[model samples]
Target chain A: MSDNTGTKVKGQSCRLPRKRFYRARAHSNPLSDSHFPIPICPAEFDYSHHYPYFFPSGGEDHKNGSASPRKVRFADIGCGFGGLLVSLSRLFPDTLMLGMELRDKVTEYVKERILALRASNPGQYENISVVRTNSMKYLPNYFGKAQLSKMFFLFPDPHFKEKNHRRRVISLQLLDEYAYALELGGIIYTMTDVEELGDWMRSCLEDHPLFEAVSEEELEADPVVKLLTSATEEGQKVARNGGQTFRAIFRRIKFEEE
Target chain B: MEETAEFVSNAGEDSASVAAVTMDVDNGLIEDDKSKDAEVAPALIAVHPFEKSVAVAVGFELRLFDLEGNCSVSLVDDSGGPSHSDAIRAIKFGANGRLFASAGDDKLVKIWATNPWHCIRTVSAEKRVSAVAISHNGHYVAFADKFGLVWLIGLEGDNAKQSNNDKKAVMILGHYCSIITRLEFSPDDRFIASADRDFKIRVTVFPKQSLKGAHEIQSFCLGHTDFVSCLAFAYPSGCANGYLLSGSGDSTVRLWDFISGVLLATCEVGAKVGSLEPNGTEDAQSPISDLCASSDGSIIAVALQYSNRVALLSCDFSNGNLSVAKVVTLEENYFPTSLGSSSLSKCLWMVMGASNLPMPGSAQLPTRLRIISGLRKDPSDYHCHDPIILEDNEVPGGQKLLSELQGSLDVTKEEAALAAAAAAVKASMRNMMIKKEYTLERREMRKKNRNDRKIK
Candidate 1:
């Protein structure tokens, strides 16, 4: 990995970041509000700042009214090291994805990693970015109602205590907010190596009225399902140790009147 | 090979049960430890529309005093269910005075018939209840849980039949993962406003078919810099639309046009109450605990957390402005935990108490009730006479009402204890409402000592 450091190609010099320098603790207290500035609402969120390629500066397209505004459709909550975002960027090159990380250094590392990838490959990796934020507290401030098509909770912190269950990323109550932000037929993907945490996430999804479990046939057909355990840093670490993983993928649905 | 060995050791250590000695060192290490066990529920007060009855919920106990009947009405519950097994967090009366709702940490939302004071229906919640509100038409009772989900139950069916079968509550809306502190239905019942600990007030359109869900959000009133603790709707005498009033831990009371989500006016209530210290530490800003608007929507009563006075503000709907009009100071060092006022009366009722106060030697915690009259609807009558703190004899129901609701009339001896209780209540409120900041090392240590990760 060090061999690629400061590599120059076609008048551009970019290098991949080493994992050892970007290590961060696994857990962050979502209740703490002392983090990055959050937009007051989804409308106030500057898409141009996050995705300059899609939303060009100077409001040229906005003035001409020729193109509809592009919005982020995919979110990876607690995207540690942003390994999944990096992997998913090529698979869906046109889709815009955001990784929300609470740790300052980890978010900075992801930002640098994305910038390096964009510089090295040009035109690619433009659809993915990372922001330092407490997603649990500021999800609505970034995403509007029915704005997202997919969400990923990959190997999130297992707040094990009964009192700390509310801190869990995937919860019955939080699913309501996720459901609000997700478009109809949107999918939420969650995976964990801990069996207890996996069961908890699955049960919460099962008990929620707005969510239904994605069938095995559908899961087997979806490409994102395979990436759940292969793309993220935590997933790779767990795989290296030969650890078993459990996944729960559910779709946001509105119940038909009975 | 060294990194692999470290990974294996970490996996092995996490799977093994942590020893008691190691666990003891991590316990109570977080800054939240001081207020962890001091979860004394603040006293909540609700008044009937006609000023004929007043209800107070301190701990698990609910006390109701009837002004017309001149007696304390006993609650009759034939459901044989346990009544309010935990601290009561919210109590509210319906618009018509026929229904009263009380919910708390017990996870039970009880609806009562006001005349008989009977538990008409008790709906079980999925989590601890935080806020409760009854629709203006008295058809639905909405309660928000600490987990941020709001549930609604229909009250149109037979009371007995509904009580016999555990009626299922329909999920209406939610405020993400934040604790919802207050819920208020717009005067027309067309909208339901919910305030959370995350400094957001969402005004959702109450659908005609609410069982489907409150999906159409009207607007989000989003200027509060801290947790919004209270919400009230004010309808100007001749205005067609009602204005939304909110109080927050940021020490400000704001008025909003809920229909359009426009912030009309903000009053720096902390400065008005004279509670902000010169140094201006974060703790110096006293959070507004409770607020209520008069029937005519001209006067507003705001209760600050650590202040011994209630600041009254006058709302001028003509220009959509709010300004502090009067600061009524209590005779004793009484910090009100809740405030209530009747629509038909010009009196403001305040309660100073908590669920389980940390008094040195007291076995029973006593509540102190005070009443102030002369809150006029006419702005011209503002300076006619200062609002009078009614003597015990002049208060409605007199000393009898005080003893019935407050538990004891002898408050002189427990003055110091009440002051201490106020401080304790303030500390717990700050712990629950204010987000705590931690250093990088502390965050790492907390993650390292997580019981879930350590004990598998």
Candidate 2:
């Protein structure tokens, strides 16, 4: 678990963090009010702090319209250990991506991981960042309506009890909020090793009126679909254990007017 | 707090079984050994648009009293469907008094015709219903579930025929994972406002075709420190747009310019009503349970969970300011659970009763109905005299109204029991609305023991 991807930066060694030291529990309750400061709305979010390289003049000057502000179009929900974000950052170099994790220590680890990578490979990994937030309650706070182009729900916590069904991240009710945040034709990518949770997620997506399953031909042509099982820590663990994974990719669609 | 600390400490030694047992107790999954028959349901009340009738839902029974006829109105359902099998959480009347909607734990939304008191449509929802509202135009009915989704159903012209087939409800919007507590249509019917347990009030534009989905969010009213419990709109004379009023579990009532999403004023009803205990424990904090605005939009009556007094606030629409005007104290040991006010009436109706009595062997609890008359729109005239608590005989339907709505209960003999019921309701409300905090190890254990994992 020690990362050897270190490089010399300003005569100092910027070393990657060890995964063992940043180990956290597998799940965190999304309903609890975690101790973290959340932006009231998307306008109030300080993008300069998360992506300082993108906003060279800082966040306040970007509102002056000297340059059109760039928004984060991709979100990785429950992005465990920031593996998927790191992979996606390289794949989509021009696109901005954000990883939302509930665990504080994991978020800190991802921050260090990104910083270390940026130091090792200069001018790269600048478009990806991580934040500690309960996305279930605050998705609308950070992303405006139709602001996102893609959403990833990789290896989500499967709240299995009948009473805890409402807590699942990929529920019909929650899809409405996701649908509101995502632009038309925006894709929602979900993957899980647990078969029941995978079925549940697929069924909820199928049942929602605003979402339509991505065609097999489109999924095969998409580069991100291939990395669903190999880009994240959870997916890597499942791969190592020789466990099969299930995926449900859906596109946000507009309803026909009656 | 101490219990959470103890559980965290114990989790280090033996995590799995201990955490599971603790969660079961915390969630009330383990049945109580003491009183199996004790049920604690909150009594809800709704008033008709023209002050023609008042409907009260307690447990599984729906009771209505016709003010003009001075008689009980029996519901006519040719389908012969059973009444509400569980506690009804919300009851509301349409703007023109043509339709009445009621839904609750049973997940059935029943739309009734007001004139004939017949159940025209019964729609079964996927989850327990929390709040419901009929559009001002009386063409649409919307209900919100505990899972934070709002569903809409369009009504056809005057169909009193009973149909047992479940009508499809269109899903319009949602509040993420939070429970939606209140749904209200703006006075002009241009927007619909939904309040959730996450302290958010979203105002979405009512689209021309709502069945397609409400996509445009006009604004978000977000200042509450706790869950929002109720919402109302007050439109002053000569004003085209109405101001929005919201009450929250944070013990405050706030007035907002919803069109622009600006918080105008906040009145600390908790401080005005005073705490039940002087020590100021968490239990002493009074959360507003229900609130209603007067016909002229001048007076707002607020009811706190554990307090025996209803605090009235005066609204100044010119400057958008709210201030506590008066406090009407009720009889000892009685706390108001719900409050109702009609557009055509000058009286504020209040009900004090619990649906399920927590006391053993007390299966039948008596509900008490009270009314306060002489509520005026002019601030000067409203302040000139104290609010008059009308006697039972002075009520619109008099003794007949009391008997029809209250079910001929003897309130004097159940004073002690009523006090206990109030305490139980307060505790249950806290448990239901407050978010529970858990340690990392306990969360892991709970996930490990998930049934989905076991099934695999």
Candidate 3:
């Protein structure tokens, strides 16, 4: 149908605008900017309507006054078609998960897909929900710092231009945000068919102050890593098109006891 | 910190939200505890685990504290939220106080986590929820709304919202248009008892897993002329052996054998006791707002709507007799909304909602609800202040007034009146006039002053 998913943004990282949620068009400014600015913090973001159970965002915990009613531990960033989210839902049935997408139409598709699955399975998919927002711009508004245990960056757009490198999903500044939202031992999973983009994400996390490269043996042990090869639509498309996909996983370094 | 949650009961936490009732300590009787703070709105109190408890109130402002003095987490504070933005109609704790659930006028049912006291799951209904009941297993929460439907949601299953099919409800039972005001699962969780505003209580068999037997009505508790507001097991902590006690708007508390659907005893607590019954109103102070039975099934507490009083009765399930043991009077202008009792500590907890400051001259605004609990053996030893302590005493405990329990003296007269009305509905007013009304025909004969008086 219509690809209203990506809008051409002007100024900074890369001058030639083909498509970007990753790189800026101008080198002067590399920070991701959205025309729709979000709230300063989560208190301004009401998520009651988005949750399956009564999250009473308006109603704080009655037992202890200060505790948040709930915390979102699973997040799927740039969840294009929500394929990974839907697939990963079965793997972590008890976990409350959320998907943040940039396009309204795609987000609607994910919601409808989730709704259909829920209706078919009754009381099953409520743990997973989707919202339409640019994760790079408003991730903190949805998840509290150190609230997430696992995050997925599956098959994000590969901005090939050398000048547009800063626009990639896994970049220097965004790594700090990712590290902030994840627990000390939390894992960040990145998968892409483009080897160069995969390498970019690997080096970005490697150089981040709060992150350390996960061992290959440890990566092999994670159940979620299995889905990286065949879960998302883009991953499946890459596999069907005879393209080699790459995976890079990193762990938050501080406060990790083991 | 390792939290060692001792055996906790369902009475609830301290402090309150909307429309709270408190007992003042001056006379060792219930006194209205007014809101010293202006920001708190009104809320609802949840009846819970029959063991030792911490009263939990979710409302305009929320308050949760231990009534038994063993609050490992010490969750007492003046806070808001964890309640419906509008009003919370009912809240009940699951079996051992492991789970808590509340229904609000917002048509939302929130199942809360107890240790931390947060709403973990929110279930939406088609109508404003009237009552909430947790299953004996503490896993399923049964709720009824303004609409006549009964919904059962399993708390342990995948979130009700995620299921592909409408698997959230184990089964749904209903009455035509009457609102279901209370729901209770038998101690065995085999049968679910439901009460409606239309003066009906239906007990339906709860199938082990599926709701296939939901349509199989076990029995019906009838005979109330007004709405039945609350129900409690005759033996709350026992085997639930086919006996239940119900309180109604007709200002009567009745004991029934659920298996036979027969009325056992009807104890009158009405106009004779100053219930402030409103003329021609079907639902008002005349209705029993809340009722509970002690674990041993020896005592049942009745709180009348707007009566501002709690009547403790000695219940004999064997002969189906209910005798008023004591009438705990709340002095001052106070409104009693809910009553809870813990069998473990034999503590009777009452929640009262007061609106004004009770000053020399102050405007009446429905301010706050207070929660107080007292040891049943010695009612005077009750505490309404020092909320977190067993001295649930915020004020003086309510004074005990010894009064003879009024037997069903009004039953025959009320039955006759009900029969007359039933006939009136069947025949026209003209037909009824021609048929000779009972009081009217006698009145005419008496006015004539015939030799009938000489014969008598």
Point out the worst 10-residue segment of candidate 3 chain B by lDDT: B398-407
Give the Cα-based TM-score of candidate 1 against the true structure.
Answer: 0.78
Candidate 1, residue B315: Cα displacement in angstroms equals: 3.4
Report the C-alpha lDDT of model 3 over B64-134, residue by residue, as the tens digit. Answer: 44434433233321222333555566777777887777676677777777756666666677676777888
lDDT of each residue in A1-258, candidate 3, tens digit only: 123223233532212212233322121111212334354345445556666343545675333367655656889998877788888889887677888877666666677667666655666776788887767545655665577999999888786767445457787646655776788799999999888998888887776656778898887788888888778878888889899988888888773212
lDDT of 1 by residue, B146-180 (tens): 76789998877552255465778888887765689
Task: Report the poorest 10 consecutive residues by lDDT, candidate 3 chain A.
Answer: A24-33
DockQ pick, better of 1 and 3: 1
- List the pairs of residues colliding in candidate 2: B39-B356, B41-B356
Please state the error at residue B119 of candidate 1 in Å. 2.7
Best by DockQ: 2
For candidate 3, the TM-score is 0.43
Cα error, residue A185 of model 3, in Å, equals: 65
Q: What is the DockQ of each candidate?
A: 0.19, 0.21, 0.01
Question: Which numbered prediction scores highest in lDDT against the true structure?
Answer: 1
Ranking by lDDT: 1, 2, 3
Candidate 2 TM-score to native: 0.78
lDDT of 3 at A250: 85
